[model samples]
Target: MSTVLELSDVTVTRSGTTILDQVSWKVDSSERWVILGPNGAGKTTMLQVAAALMHPSLGTADVLGQRIGSVDLFELRPRIGFASTAMARRVPASESVIDVVLTAAYSVTGRWNEQYEELDVRRASRVLAEWKLSHLEQRRFGELSDGEQKRVQIARAVMTDPELLLLDEPAASLDLGAREELLQLLGGYASSPYAPGIIMVTHHVEEIPPGFTHALLLDQGKVAAAGPIGEVITSEVLSGTFGLPLTVDETDGRFTARAADR
Candidate 1:
């Protein structure tokens, strides 16, 4: 399988603080990986590196077969699909849902004078349909619920058919029903043979979708464990990663975690 991302001894330091330290990870085109970590674990920092939005302070990052520092970012960034609450916050609230997805064709956040062909519009519409957001195409983006907005962000991210897909807490701040709904859609997309390599960062094991194949656990800016989901998501691994006794179980391809003593 082709390697989608490779980070070797990558570290991110800023303002005299280190966010990620000596993180060496590889993601192949056929794998769907989920990153699990607590607050300040550098999960988002790692995602930013994968997205080519930030450069590592040390080591090298190769995304889509191109070295980050040597490649032109504007050309490289469009090849990676990224969804996050930070990205959603950049969207112009007054923009229409279709516009939100369409702007992604040029990696922009709002509608401008940039022209799009009929093909682009059709693609955006198709993506919205796939995400079950076709009915809201003409709706104002700001008017959507948290779940709807999250889906819109994902739809926008995939609009360009990126080679690597990265999601940061795609299911955050939603009710149980909405979270499950989004997870189902995400599961279907991740399972597709045509889906690109995916890396999602989430705090809860419950947020991981059914189709994910790998797990990377982080603790205090270091890799705790990285391997097949089943092997790395065990109670033993999680309890240590989180600094507490924790239990992890899977049923029907879904995972649940809680304190082991509970």
Candidate 2:
């Protein structure tokens, strides 16, 4: 399978502190990956690199066949969709849900002109519908609940038909029911042949949707384990990665993790 993302000796430092240390990893076009790590593990940094939002300080990073640093990020960015709480706040609160999604096609966070093509609107509507936000198309972006807003952000990410999609903590602020609904939607996308190579970052195993094939575990900015989900997401690895005794279970392609009671 072709490599969709590649990182060779990648390191990221900020304010003289190492955020990601010599992380070498690859995501092939055929697999969907989950990045699991506790807070401050540099999972978001890794996603930023994959999304072309940041460059490695030490080594080479490539996405969708283009090396970071050498390519025009403006052109490459549209080909890689990124959705996160951080990104959601960047969107204008006044924009309509449909326009918020449509702006992605032009790589703009806020709508400036109301001249979107008919086909673009059609595509945006379809994406929103798939994400279960069709009824909120005309609602103000800021008026939606956290769960609803998350779905809209995800729909916006796929608006440009990206080659790689990065979703950071998609289930973070949602309640159990909303999280499950979002997970099912993500699972459906994960199994789609036309879906982009996906990398989702989360701190909890329960947040991993079905059909995700690989896992990358990070601890204190270092990779603790990386491989097939069934291999790397074991109880032992989970315990080590979080620095606590934990049990991980999987059934019917879904995963769950819990702390081992003392």
Best by TM-score: 1
Candidate 1, residues 5-58: lDDT per residue as tens digits? Answer: 999999999998999999999999999999998899999999999999999999
Question: What TM-score do all the candidates reach, one by one?
Answer: 0.99, 0.98
* TM-score, structure 2 vs. true: 0.98
* Candidate 2 accuracy as lDDT: 0.93
Off by over 4 Å in 2: none
Query: What is each predicted model's overall lDDT from 0 to 1?
Result: 0.95, 0.93
TM-score of 1: 0.99
- What lDDT tens digits, residue by residue, belong to model 2 across residues 208-254? 99999999999888989999999999989999888899988999899
Per candidate, the number of residue pairs that clash is 0, 0
- Winner by lDDT: 1
